[model samples]
Target: MSEQAPHPATGLSALLASTPFARAYTHTALAAVFAAFAVERIAGSVALATILGGLAVLGVGILVARRAEYSLVRLAPTTLLMFLAWTLTTVAWTGDRGRTLAGWVALAGIALIAVVVALVRDTLQIVRALGDVLRWLLSISLGIEILSGVLLDIPIPFLGIQGRIAELGPIQGIFGTRNMLGFATVIALITFLIEYRTLSVRTGVALFSVILGGVTAVLTDSPTVFVVAVAVALVTAALVVVRNAPPERRRVLQWVLGAIVVVAGVTGYALRSTLIGVIGAGTDLSLRTDLWSTLVPLVRFRPVYGWGWFGPWAPAEFPFNYVNAVLRESHASALNAYLDVLVQAGWVGLLLFLAFAGVALLRSWLDASQRRSVVYAWTPLILVALLVDSLFESFTLSGFGWFLLVLCAVRAGQSRSWRERMRSLDGPPGGVETLPAAGGVQGPDISRG
Candidate 1:
């Protein structure tokens, strides 16, 4: 018998799998780990979640060190450091020291993961990674929803279905809440739209994913998510149109935008009640107002640094217990991200976070406006969506959403850092050699598109 020779295709597969491109799988896996934690009910054992997170952290640590730039001063903005410092400092004042310490550990872990992602993967790679993860996650959730709602005749409460599993549902998919699933769907839809616009090879698949994600959001029956999705879609389209418009019109457009925003704000204030009813939030945000009414008084106890972060409530545990007792509910958060931050870290932390978000949004938006590539647009759009979502959901406190926020902030900060460096080098501008203008988020890989 002739000796069997190794197949060329098999060798090529192995070669490709060993390259940095193959890190897409690792990125997807990291996302899955974060999703498991985010969708805790469906994620099985805590130990499994920890192990997965650990492995991903280790893998990403190694890869980031090998493949990307690493500098604390360059990558970590002052706002970020301030936030971390405040969070750590507050641990000292937390009532349940152990619990707060544990929380800090988890928070640090997530922060490290964000650094790894932002530093190692460029903008295009980040988009591809996000696309891979969203496609996988949405597909799984859709499959499970079909199994429970269509065929199984069983409610999988962990997966967010309850009673009457036979019909198409108010299913939450794998996210544990209808709004969460809807939020995820909105994000996936936007990402896939961007991907479809930029990448020709998988345009059909991306479009189909966008459709599936949109349908899932609609099925979730979350008015907030549906409304925000439409708003974001419109905003994204408008931004792209403006970006491609003649450069001379850009400044005029900016002035027009500012005027439009002022008008919109006035109109919204006048029609506040009517708009609230239109969105089905009811007059009181389904009793969130009541919850806030109760919680706001307690924030006065330590107004400057209200309560410490780390635990579910303030340290000394006086007012939180009282609030929970009064509400007849074991509430973990204020149900609003900003309000929660104010409660936990007080005015100082809240201000730091706001500055961080404001700077990040401004920089990312500027980059998106200047860059022609659709891939460069995701950062700003995602930031806008999250900012809108944060009003209704406290997702910024944890999960992949928080991780992405940190990543974008770091990237924006890095871009600003590079630009500043160029500016410093070009001091006394006459006779100085011209330096390359700092590029946008679109990485070198985007040229292939």
Candidate 2:
């Protein structure tokens, strides 16, 4: 008797899992990795190593498996790689060499995983994976709040739930801070909205997801939520207007928007004293300002080379401990992404980071404005969230925040990177994009309808 072949669907799935720029396998892995990022506090620092190690191994395996598909010349965006390279270089001069190396590993490892996912998965797929992970996380967050507040009536010290859900929290959720929960829910809200707008999820599911995100975000009770909501709302409105504009008028509209943003920023700065008074600046506001002020003097000592690349401040590290001691506070991060980079990697690193974010934002924003597809909007909106949130928190420097930043950068870079232009003119394979009919996140089935 002839040997029986595996069932066609099973064979197809298995084949896809191991194929070039593998999707199903990568999607599953990405979801797990993202989930790990969300609930990292559950297991402590080892969780990062464990999850990232798993991702790193999977990343290398995929690259090896898909060797024929990759082109060294047309690899990741120059800006991204340059930034990573600069971060790695910081280990040479860091105060704590061991910690720096460890930090660089997490940074580079997350970047690698993001690069892989950005290559293999489309925008919707990434959104889908993130949405699923966030839904589980948010649901769990709500459950834990219920258990800790209404049901059990005891604070969960390990998870940092303060049993304040009964008081309509400031809930930390699976994230370790209220601000973090607010940020994640904002991202979830955006993802859920995109899923709805794109018809990627069923109507009921999308609606439920939106409600869930809203409820969770509200319960977080973070002041950042207000700022984030406004920023996202404004950006969403601008994108809608830009996308709907005539192709010829779109450029003019963008310039007008830029001018308006400049004017608004200047006005805000001029009135900052009044605004500060209105907002009661003595709270979180003063802490950030004081933290940044302390970081400024430290950054000056090694302005060019920096203190080295510790993503999150190590309490035991010299300058970190020094800064914390000066403030008499146990701050985990510098509370600002730019300030964090300035203190850790110095001026050159800051320049590289600015270029990295600026280029990505410009590319993605242009893509969103020009493309008729709604998927094009995700990258820019996400970048806006990350960049804006960076002002208040260093979330974008690590964890899922960094992952999203890199992932969006990769997505944007693919549309209009130098490598893409080179590949077009040269007419050869363009690094992991050799697969047929697999385009950059533009699932044609989804519509503006």
Best by lDDT: 2
Error of 1 at 173 (Å): 1.3
Q: Lowest-scoring 10 consecutive residues by lDDT in candidate 1?
A: 428-437
* Model 2 per-residue lDDT tens digits across residues 100-152: 98888888888888887776666666777777778888999899899999999
> Which window of ten consecutive residues has the lowest lDDT sum in model 2?
430-439
Candidate 1: Cα lDDT at 10: 60
Model 1, 1-449: lDDT tens per residue?
99998898666544433436446544754565447634466446575557547755664544443432233345456777788888778877766667666666666667666765565556666666777888887787778777776778678755556633245557676677777778888778777876776663265787788788877887777777865786687668768767987888987886776588678778977997888888777833766777798978878887778567763354336567777788787666676788888887889989988988888888887777776666667887888787778777777776666777787787666555453464454332111111123322343331112
lDDT of each: 0.67, 0.79
Q: What lDDT is obtained when candidate 1 is compared to the true structure? A: 0.67
Off by over 4 Å in 2: 1-34, 37-41, 276-282, 425-449
Clashing pairs in 2: none
